[model samples]
Target: MISIKRFSELSYKEAVVLWNEGFKYYFSNMTMTVDAFIRKLANEGLSPEHSVVAYVDHVAVGFAINGFREMDGKKIAWNGGTGIKPEFRGQGIGKVLIEACLDVYREQGVDLALLEAVAQNERAIALYKKMGYEVFEELVFLQQNGAMTIDAFHTNSNFEIVRGIPEDIQLLEFFQPIKAWQVQVPGCKGAESIIVKKGNEVLAYAVYQRMMDEKHNIQTIALNQCEIKESIDVQKVADFILYHVFQPHHKIKRMVRNLSKNNRLVYNTLLAAGFETLVEQVHMSNRLDQPIKESIQ
Candidate 1:
């Protein structure tokens, strides 16, 4: 027989074990220390109260972490992470974990829920589809080795660059539409924004998060009120950012902006900047036509 328990009921060691098991299943060489996992959970607000652990005969076999936040005035929930022990496969544990997460969302007044699964994870994808989840976007995870130089690109007479600050949170709030998931990471600091200003007008802006790995992650970028006259040329901007921000490091890896299937300009920009897709994940959501309006911009 199987039982589901709140994450709070388990000790920290048990939670870490479940987390490591799930990560290793997807990435064979993954070895996240307990400290790192704990930090991530705390950062993402994945406490035992919001998470679920499954056990069989008093042994933990699977677990799921969930998080919720307000976006665009609507409550949103995310399946932060989940995994089942290898020996417990084909026993419907994944389904149970997912259902438990959805139940939490429903009780929390979350109108929408979201998750990402590797594109090749057919079993998980099928299960999600069967549970009323639909594909909203496809995310490409890209990475690169060594340092690269960014070049300054000349654009036609239209926009100028302006530095942004946290005070511009209201303006940045405009980006809730294209963001994948929303959560606050207070310890994850050092965010900078650059606006493409047309004289006194602010057209588009990009927000980047500085990572400890000496790489800058493009958390979100958006153009508002007006469409970009010319493609903002992502390659030049990325190169410029890296050259100005990243120093010589053993390796540099950052998560780039999310791209829709039809967005070719940004795609080409990442590719031109030497970012090769390491993996592809399918973004599944329970809300199809919901409005999102928080800007990481």
Candidate 2:
């Protein structure tokens, strides 16, 4: 028999053990030390009480990491991750965990639940679909190593680009909130934003983070979000945004986090810059408009 327990009941060390076990065969290296695990919870606003772990015969064999945030007056829950030990696969434990997570979401008054899964993970995708989650878009982490050769975005007296905080992007006339969970302001720790304006009208904006070296020189640059008005030349604005966020002068590693493939201009721009797709996932979301008690009970 299987049993589910709130992660709050387990020690961080146990969380690490269960986490490592849950993601043992994941697409990427998800191994976590106790310190890193704690940091993730803190940085991502995940709570032990809101997450769940599975056990069989008192041995933890599965887990789900969930997080909550309020956006646009609606409560949103993110399924940060979910995994089951290889030995425990093919059973109905995963389904039970989903039901438990739904319970958490309902209790927390979540308006919507979102998650991402590796595109190649058919079983997981199918399971999520069965649970009423719909695949909305493809998201990819694009990467480029070594020096960047970015094209300059020319500007006359009418154009100016300036540095700003992540919140500034929201002030733009046509800013769209980033749909990816980790890149949003709440989850994007140490991130900064930039805005380009033609006279007093904003044309484009971007949010990025730089990882510094011991000497404070640029070691890596990461672009999290970029948006341009509908009327602007997307390719040109995208190139310009990359030029600003990536900074062609530095010989450093660079990346774009979980960008939606549907955003053709930005996604294609990254590809044109030789940024290879490092990771690809299917973004899924489930509306929480109905009551969960009937289905869950």
Each model's TM-score, in the order given?
Answer: 0.77, 0.93
After aligning candidate 1 to the native by TM-score, how far in Å is the CA of 110 from where it should be?
Answer: 0.8
lDDT of 2 by residue, 163-194 (tens): 97888776666766537888887777799988
Error of 2 at 166 (Å): 0.7
Q: lDDT scores for all predictions?
A: 0.61, 0.82
| Tens-digit per-residue lDDT, 222-296, candidate 1 | 211111223355444433333333332334544553444344555555566566777688788886334544222
> Model 1 clash pairs?
8-48, 150-239, 172-295, 173-295, 175-295, 176-294
Instruction: Give me the runs in candidate 2 sitting further than 4 Å from their true place.
Output: 150-158, 290-297
Residue 50, candidate 1: C-alpha displacement in angstroms: 1.8
Q: What TM-score does candidate 2 reach?
A: 0.93
Model 1 Cα shift for residue 244 (angstroms)? 6.6
